[model samples]
Target: MSIRTVLLHAAPDSGFNDRLAFAVALARQSGAAIKGLYTLYPAGVPRVGRALSIYVNELVREAKEKEGGLKAQFEQATAAAGLAASWETIEGEVASSLREAVAFADITVVSETPYGTVDDQLAATLPEHLAMACNGPVAVVPTGKPVPARIGKVLIAWKPSREAGHAVRFALPVLAAADEVEVFTVEEGDTTTADSGAKLAAWLATHGVNAKHRHVAEGNAGHAITNEVQKFGADLLVMGAYSRSRFAEMVLGGVTASLLVDPPVALLIAH
Candidate 1:
């Protein structure tokens, strides 16, 4: 019932070190082994096209030095955390190596890519990036402040759909870890008519979770869920990452899209 191994994708810059330390601390608490995965792309691609930057070598020497420093820092962090950790430098084709690493470990946390659109691209390309990989659930931790600890209060965004079901299942560990598990369902379609929340509550009872069902009527599901989380003092959220047809998202953003941009609580999503 504990996280045994965690796979963390390290980044080019040192910003990722803080994330790694947090992961290491959690792993230590859970008696999990930490796997340090490094993606080694060709040092310093020409920033501009050959016409503009052929003469500019991009100072690859700086990249080389940075990479070395990063590795040393990773080792130091691992040692400081007092947990088992290993390092692997992969000849990366970017997302491909990440998929492989996620598949190789029990739990995966990806460092956000610097393409200026990783969050948007994450929803679009996650399937391809994961590629039927990852035997266990993965955590795509967005680059920001470190996730808070003592995750006792959790809000489950529930809907009668396969996506929502998978989200709940994938978040079983976290839910089991929480002291308060709120099954927050917003009005959508005939959800209340069919007593969808009751079914979910029964299922959770079978699994020994005393989850409370809260039905929110007449509001946006995403916003309602966020408000409910705040009302209940929830620290973590369990939700499904839903992808709409590219056209639908553009015309009017869906709950998933809105949540991705600004989730009130730390989210654990299953797509």
Candidate 2:
């Protein structure tokens, strides 16, 4: 129920600093330990010639140098924040390494994937993949945006499913601390009861979170959720990820896909 350890993915990229700062702030707020995890690109072997081998070695060296710099930045930031932290480097594919690292963490903080071509598979899908594999919760910070000073208002995309219920429970610590929380559900027909959203709000009330329930008209689930986020001025949006399979989501375009593609705010997702 409490955040005791926060796992942050550290990379030598544009959004790394913002993600690290956000993770550090969350750790400071919850008095949790921060674990900085970096995945090093696996060194490749050259079978052609000595020159190619030398080039490969050079690439590996440059990667290590960059990793060292990133580690230093992470350490300095955590120190400045006065939070207990640790760092580790994994040698393998980024997503796989992150999935393994999330096992020991209560929550994982990652940057939103840059919108573009899917040339970089890991970067494009890391957050979603982590949400599925982490078994806890993954907090995704939007790329190029600094963490908000306060997460006072939160929007919960309620869908009356085991996954959504898990997400709400996993985010209880944050919800309990928020000044205001709204639980919104989009009705696709009579498939969902009229009081479904209110039921979630009532459950949250038991945990001391006085949440307002809103029922939205049937439409695109993703757009409806985003509209609610904008209307409520929510600093954080909590929801379940991949109610469908990843392949299905990728092709069919579900709420998970929409949020990952263009997150309206910081998102806390669980699967």
The parts of candidate 2 lying over 4 Å away from their true place are 42-59, 116-122, 190-193
Pairs clashing in candidate 1? Answer: none
lDDT of 2 by residue, 1-271 (tens): 7889999988776678778877887788778899988776531233368897676566556667898889988999999988899998876657777788788898999888785533233377678878887778999988776477667899999887777888999999889888899999888775573488888899899999999998877888889899888999998999988877889987887898888887988899999
Model 1 poorest 10 in a row by lDDT:
119-128
lDDT of each structure?
0.63, 0.82
Q: Which ten residues in a row have the lowest lDDT in candidate 2?
A: 39-48
Q: Under the 3 Å rule for N, CA and C atoms, how many clashes does model 2 have?
A: 0
**On a 0 to 1 TM-score scale, where does candidate 2 land against the true structure?**
0.88
Clashes of each: 0, 0
lDDT for model 1, please.
0.63
lDDT for predicted candidate 2 compared with the true structure: 0.82
* Top candidate, metric lDDT: 2
Give the C-alpha miss distance for residue 204 in model 2, angstroms: 0.8
